[model samples]
Target: MNETENDYHGYTPMDYDEDSAADEAYQTCVSYIVEHAPIERDDTVVDVGTGTGIVALELASKCDRVLGRDIDDEWLRYAREKAAERGVENVSFDHGSFREPNVEEAVDVVVASYALYMAYDEGGEGTLRAAIEGISSLNPRHLVVADKMFFGPPEPRGGYETLPRMGTVANLLADTGFTLTDVEIVSGSAGVLVASRTSG
Candidate 1:
């Protein structure tokens, strides 16, 4: 393998199963997008924090094209291979950070899955601000964020007290000029928050 391929993030595409149960998580997220988005067949969608191209591949079928962006080159390679395996010609991957996406092309819809949370620390105040700005810079017609809020008792991985409440993020979105359009909680373990760009 080339050094570039090996030096990328630790993610190995082959390590992720295309048919894993986690795929249900992806599918659930996609369903939320199709439901809340004013998606059009001609729209070009961007899947920020796209891991293994799951959301990007799903969007490819519903949009004119789909681009998956991630900072990990290994994950990008894996995403490309997955796209190739599925013969999804309209889906592509780029090695970049969604927090500071570097793409010239504007998209119609931007979807950020669980990947957004990793960009922040406890409380996620700064992280949410950066995330909103990053998504806004894309100038997409809509922004969809799929994340989970921990409201349970304390645990080793940090519990509710260690994380920002969903309402905190909702307020952060408002402060950053995003209007909440829909909210959904899945399996009592995750919450999906969808919002649209609005003037500050």
Candidate 2:
């Protein structure tokens, strides 16, 4: 396994569940992303950085198919295990990343939570832009991003100094042909952004 896979506080696939179990904000973000993704019964949804397939599994019933992508192969394995244990057939977990989701040329919707920062926090601002643009290129009609982001003064929190700013992401989305339609601020630093494709 890659050392960077768990470098973010030694997070294993199980820890994602455990963390949400312990952090209300985290769970809120996760649930909110699934509930407000604008997924249709015939839609195909791709979830980036799908740590353990929690969101992918929950969304399978709402969409025709769900693709869960993660940089860590172990996380994908764990996600597959969860899908099997839950008898979720429409969701597939695979190796992918925020920068290269490995999805089809077009999808109905793309959703990510507690994962976007991996683009910025790990790779910096340019990577974050590429990540968002990559998702835009998928031609998904909508995007739902939920993570610990700055809603106020930009400052380090939870030991992460490069948290994405809500405004910055919104601007990038708009530049990439998406428009912000809704936002749910779970906390000062945790929130969800819902945007729709407006051009092309």
The residue-level lDDT of candidate 2 at 89 comes to: 91
Candidate 1's residue-wise lDDT over 34-112, tens digit each?
6666668998888877767766787787889888888767678888998898899998788656557767786788888
Say which candidate scores most in lDDT: 2
* Off by more than 4 A, model 2: 1-4, 8-11, 156-159
Model 1, residue pairs in steric clash: none
Model 1 deviation from native, Cα RMSD in Å: 4.6
Q: How high is each candidate's TM-score? A: 0.80, 0.91
Candidate 1 Cα deviation (angstroms), residue 146: 0.9
lDDT to native, each model:
0.69, 0.81
| Global local distance difference test of model 2 | 0.81
List pairs with backbone clashes in candidate 2.
none
Q: Write candidate 2's Cα lDDT for 9-92 as tens digits.
A: 666778778876899988888788767778899999998888888788888889899988887887888989999998899999
